[model samples]
Target: MTATIPLGSRISGERLAVLLGEWRRRGSRHGSTDLAAAVEMYVLDGQLPIGTRLPAERELAAALGVSRTLIGAALDRLREDGIVASRQGAGSWIAGTGARRRDLEIPVTDGIFDLAKAAPSALPGLTAAADAARHDLAAYVTGNGYVTGGLPSLRSRIAERYTARGLPTTEEQVMITGGAYSAFVLCLRMLAGPGDRVLVEQPTYPNALDALRAAHALPVPVALDPGEGWDLAGVEAALRQASPRFAYLMADFQNPTGHRLDAEQRERLGGLLARTRTPVVIDESLVELDYDSDPLDGPPPLASFAGELSLTLGSASKSHWGGLRLGWIRASADLLDRLLSSRFAVDLGAPVFEQLVLAAMLEPAGYAALAQRRQDFRGRRDALAAALGHYCPDWTFTMPSGGLSLWCRLPKPMSTRLAVSAANHGVQLAPGSRFGVHGGMERWLRVPFALPSEHLSEAVRRLSLAVASVRSCAGVPAVNVPVA
Candidate 1:
């Protein structure tokens, strides 16, 4: 005989208890499917938000009057459907929505050590900076305390740092905002509007693309050639063809691909950019995190070449910690003045505490701490590369000397499928298509080795299994590809 499962607790606690007792007697065979169904009913009824944390396993099992083993099975099934996620110690949360339509469960697993996000948390000395910011707060407590225009001291410090980096900047040429994305939004608002063309790399950051859409700008994609790093020739061609009014470039330690434009290319691109009169928005977020090359000493800043035509955005997120939402834009003095006046319409400014903290981090000692972090990241990158080389030979990848991720090009165009398969094995990966312009990077995958060495090795092992799975399904003849 079939058994009826209570939909939710809405029927009253007594009725739920009675119903649970009835279902418990039906045994495991009937209870498992019923439990998953009940969870689905809760989601459909809007009882849980995407990313809502669920109760503890013991508590949930007790409440449902079911064994923990049964609850785990139900959760496993939900996870297969992408309905929920359970971190080993971090508890489970409802996965977010996706473009593809499927019954929601938990989300894709980023690696136990997630290489997806390039940024890390604050290093060891951040507590001292936080303490300093607390002191700074005492003087500002009497004022409005809203940091819409940013703390003056921070603006000056950022400008000074820009000057130190070879790009002459002044306090008037800077404006502090939240992170890089927030800074980009503020600039896009001031520079472009609906129907305006903005050029971006083909395999660009997804959130930035979303921001462009939010700004109502038409996005024109310039493809990045995995073989030659970013396609300089394509960039030039796109400039002439698209005639976009604004553009964004990460010339140093670019995100997915980890490619940096050399001095000559920067110079050539800068001249070409000037002729187009398109304001280039350069994300120098990862500039300080480089690992493969010699420490940057005297090369001209990417913005130096762009001259008045550039707006350079920097952030402490990657160099410091993602938790610190501090980012600044360095532009021509006049542009900075204009942006400052226009910015009030969106946000008052970054939080005063964060500005104070970042300002403290900008000091010489703070930079030394960051240097240590860079060295650590370098070791992790090398370790990840070694793991990949040892396990997955058919896949080709470029070793980004400094950035957080390795942009790997696989032998087959199965990045999306591989991401799905990887989730089944407990490793979440950012698909190559996520980076491509208008969905083009099907053969590429971005992997980061930013986690601890042990997690990096495990992630690589899972990735190799995933690649093998993808290859087996593709049924293509195996061909060797070079990966550094």
Candidate 2:
């Protein structure tokens, strides 16, 4: 008989109930579909990992204030979809590794707007850059193409950009990777291990949290407010108490919430981390996407304030193009050497052609592309905000200074339910719990404005429909319903 490896941990009925906040039947129907859809969304969003043992049907029903028959019906739906598996005597567990296969498929169909991903479309001049790169690639075709630490010329360009941005860097301090995700994983693998705690903001990039989990690092979250920015006191408390192996933060144009740490907060955070000698990884993927008139007004790189323990990460995926798949890490020479030693386990190096294309994008012509993106994004942001105000007035959100998405707080804690309902209305959303470390921010949602203005307006209209369905289910009155 083969021994089954134990799943990470079992979530209690109480915790699961908190995660399934207000998952009532929508669309004026009392059925198991809503419950089933909510669970599917939770699993798909990484809130519920595969192989997790679910609570007993009776226990779950009691916790959710629903009947056991309803819970059974919901589990039946999950089982049919391969989202959950049941045993004769043992119990139920989240099945088939990570998200339903259907949800992962991004279909290129019209009338369906996917607001789940925050990335924008490819920038202008990308084709021209790729064409130029092919010509440049001919020069290196003869030599061995696999350079683990990345191409020297590309690294030099990346290092120069970092130095110009207030942090003195050199080619030796930079290591190129596939993208920002790769850079983060490499850093985490080098710094943390199983059972080690990694400090993070309360709400952060979902993929980063997934990366930390993959590295087996226990994430300790410090509260960060969308309106007020980082809670330095909470961060200090976590650092002093948790003694985390490292702290991963998005200092500029933070994802989902789109809050940037101020200069003073940066200094204070750096000083505290330096005092503790804790290594910090600053994700600057969205740094260059600032919508401000005076780009110089943004906070300086966090590495400028921190000591040797700090490392900065940047990527061309956001500013230039996601298809390019080029990102770099800026660290001291010693740390760079350590990361390089382990880099081979993941990838040989970033593609030579992509590196060349990114290098060209860093030149003067690329600045024009970036400026055009800024203007386009600013207009889209305004359109999204207006649409949200017109369609869902009860919802509240702060205007993001920069970054791609709006972290919105729904009138009630129905983000997960709303996401499930929204999918039925031909719109996809990233619920708030996706960004949270645990599963408690059921009142929030991340609405990306990276799509076209018409799509943004249509998404809001669909969301209003979802909200109405929820209100109808809960017997609440809707005062305003915008005409589509």
Candidate with maximal TM-score: 2
Per-residue CA lDDT of model 2 for 154-200, tens digit only, reads 89988887777778888989888999988999999899999898888
Local distance difference test values of all predictions, in order: 0.71, 0.78
lDDT for model 1 comes to 0.71
RMSD (Cα, Å) for all candidates, in order, is: 18.7, 9.4
TM-score for model 2?
A: 0.76
Best by lDDT: 2
Tens digits of per-residue lDDT for model 1, 277-395: 87899988888886654334635677777769799898888788878888888888788778888988888778888888988988889988978888888888888888988888777
